[model samples]
Target: MSKQRVLTHIDAAGRPVMVDVSGKAVTARQALAECRVRFPADVAAQLRKSGLRSAKGGIVDAAVIAGTMAVKRTHDLIPFCHPLPIDGIRIAIDWHGERELRIDCMVKTTHRTGVEMEALTGATVAALTVYDMCKALSHAIVIGPAKLVGKRGGKRDVGRVV
Candidate 1:
C-alpha cells in the first residue's frame, strides 16, 4: 500500500480516526468566533426599534439559545469529533453599525481537545438563526464571513484581529 499523509485527527494510517487525547493533560480551553449579518437600512431601523423581535420571540434570544445548543452538539454534527463535556457557552449579539449585526460565541471546556469547533459552530448557527428571523423583512439580508476571533489552550493560543 502507498504511504499516505496522516490527518491531524487520524492515526498513522489514512483511515478515518478520532484523535486520542487520553494522554493529554486536561486544561481550561476557550475559543471565540464571530459572524456578521448585513441587513438593509429599513430592516436595520426596524430591528433597532423592535429590538430584533418576531412573533416567535426575541431574535437575539433565540439565536443565543440556538448557538448554545449547537456548541453542545458540535461533536455529533461533525465527523471525526470526540464528544466533549463543555463547561460553558455564551453567545452575544450586537449591532455593529447601521446595517451590520455582529454575533460572537465563546465556548469553554477543560478537556483534552480545544473547543474551537464548538465556538465556530455556535457563531455560525447564531448567524443562521438571525438570517431566518429576518428573512421575512427582505431577501437582501446577507450573512458573511464567520471567523475565529481568538483561542486559548493546547499547544498555542490565538488572538483576534488587531
Candidate 2:
C-alpha cells in the first residue's frame, strides 16, 4: 500500500475537517508541553524578593490553577476540537535562572485522541498568566514559543523535541 497521507483532518480538496475517532481504542494518553517567559532584570529581582505573594494569591499558585483550568477547557476554547474527559492535568512553573521562568504542563486521558493540544494550551496559558501578572513590573516581559515536548498513545508515540 502507498504511504497514507496525514490528511485525515483534511478532505481531498484540502479543506479543514475534524477527524472521526469513534473507532479508535480508548487508552491512556499523556502529553507534555513547555513554554518560557523572560523578565527584565529589575522585574525578576522584584519578584524574587517579594516571595510568592503579589496581590494575586501567590503567583505560582494562581498560574497552576489557571493552567489546569485551561487544559480541561481546551476543547471549548479551540473550535473543532473534540471534548475529552481529562483524567489528570498538572502544571509546574519554575524559575529558570534569575531572568526567565519555565512553565510545563502535563495532561493525561484515556480517550480516542491524544492530549497534546491540552498540554500545549495549558503551558501557553500559564505563560500568559505569568506575563499578565508581571506586566505591572515591566512591559519588557517576553513570552517565548510553546512546544510539545513529548506524547504517547494514538497510532504512534512522538518523542521528538522542537
Candidate 3:
C-alpha cells in the first residue's frame, strides 16, 4: 500500500496539533494570494462611472484596510495558525475586466513559519469586504476562487497562475 502523506497538523495519535516551528530558523518569507469579485455588467458600469465608490464609501480603499487587518489577525481566525510579526502587507484591488475586480494581497515577514495562510486570509477578506460594500447595488455579486498564487522561503517555493 502506498504511504499516506503526513499532515503537519496531525500527529501519530491522529490528533490535531499545531505544527512545531520552534526549531526552525527565522527567515524572510513572503506569500501572494488573490481573489476575484464579479459584478453584474450594469452594476460594473455604474461602479466605473462612480469611481468605484459605493454609498458607504470608497470600495477599494475599505477593502485594502480590511485586508491588512485580516493579515494581522489570521492566527486568531484560523485555529492552527501561528501568530507571527508581520513585516509588511500590500493589498491591491483592480479591475480584471468590465465585470470583475481582482484583489491581490502580498504579505512579508521574518518568522519561523510560512505566511501563506495570512496572505490567503487577507485576499479572501478583502474580496468579502468589497462584496459587502457593493451589495446595495445588487445581491448577485460573486466572490470566489481565492487562492495562494505564490510562496517563498519555506521548505518549498511554489508559483501557480490560477
Candidate 4:
C-alpha cells in the first residue's frame, strides 16, 4: 500500500490555514510553471503577419511584464502562500505550434518554503493577459493546461524543467 498524503494547509479541525514554515530550514529553491494560449486559426495567421502586435501593443512583451509582476505578488493573491524574497523571475512566451503560444515562468528564492505557487500564478496570469489583450480579435481564444513543470527544495524536488 502507498502512504497517505497529508495536506499541509489544513488544521486538525479541517479549517483552511496557511502551512507553517517557521521551523523548516531555509534553502535555495526554484520552480517552473507553464500555461498555453491557443488562438483561433485566422487570428494566428494575422498575429504572425503582424509580428505579434495588436491594437493594445506587443502581445509577448505585455505577457512577460504581467507574469513577472504576478510572480512577485503571489503571496498577496493566494491565501496560503508565504511572502518570499524572490531571487529571480523569468517569463518566456513563444509559439508552440501553428496556433498555440506557450508561456513559461520560472521563480527562484532562498527561503523556508518552495516557490511552485509563484511560478504557477505567474504563468497563468501571463496567459490570461494575452487573452485579454487579444479578445478584440476573436472570442474563440482558449487558455489552459496550466501546470507546474518542475520545482526544487522543500520536502523533495519535483519534476525538472527548470
lDDT of 2 by residue, 101-154 (tens): 999899999999999999999999998888777777789999987999999988
Q: What's the true lDDT of residue 49 in model 1?
A: 91
Pairing residues by index, what is the TM-score of model 2? Answer: 0.91
**Global fold similarity of model 1 (TM-score):** 0.89
Worst 10-residue lDDT window for candidate 2 reads: 52-61
Candidate 2 Cα outliers beyond 4 Å, as residue runs: 1-5, 160-162
Any runs in candidate 3 off by more than 4 Å, and if so which? 1-4, 160-162
- Model 1, which residues run further than 4 Å from truth? 1-6, 10-13, 160-162
Writing each residue's lDDT as its tens digit, candidate 3 over 92-161 gives: 9999989999999999999999999999999999999999999999999999899899999967789942
In model 1, the Cα lDDT at residue 22 comes to 89
If both were scored by lDDT, which would come out higher, candidate 1 or candidate 3?
Answer: 3
> Residues 1-162, candidate 1, lDDT per residue (tens digit)?
976754686556666777778899899889999999999999999989997897667999989999999999998899977788999888889999899999999988999889888898999999999999889888999997899999998878999621
lDDT against the true structure, per candidate, is 0.88, 0.87, 0.94, 0.94
Cα lDDT for residue 118, candidate 3: 97
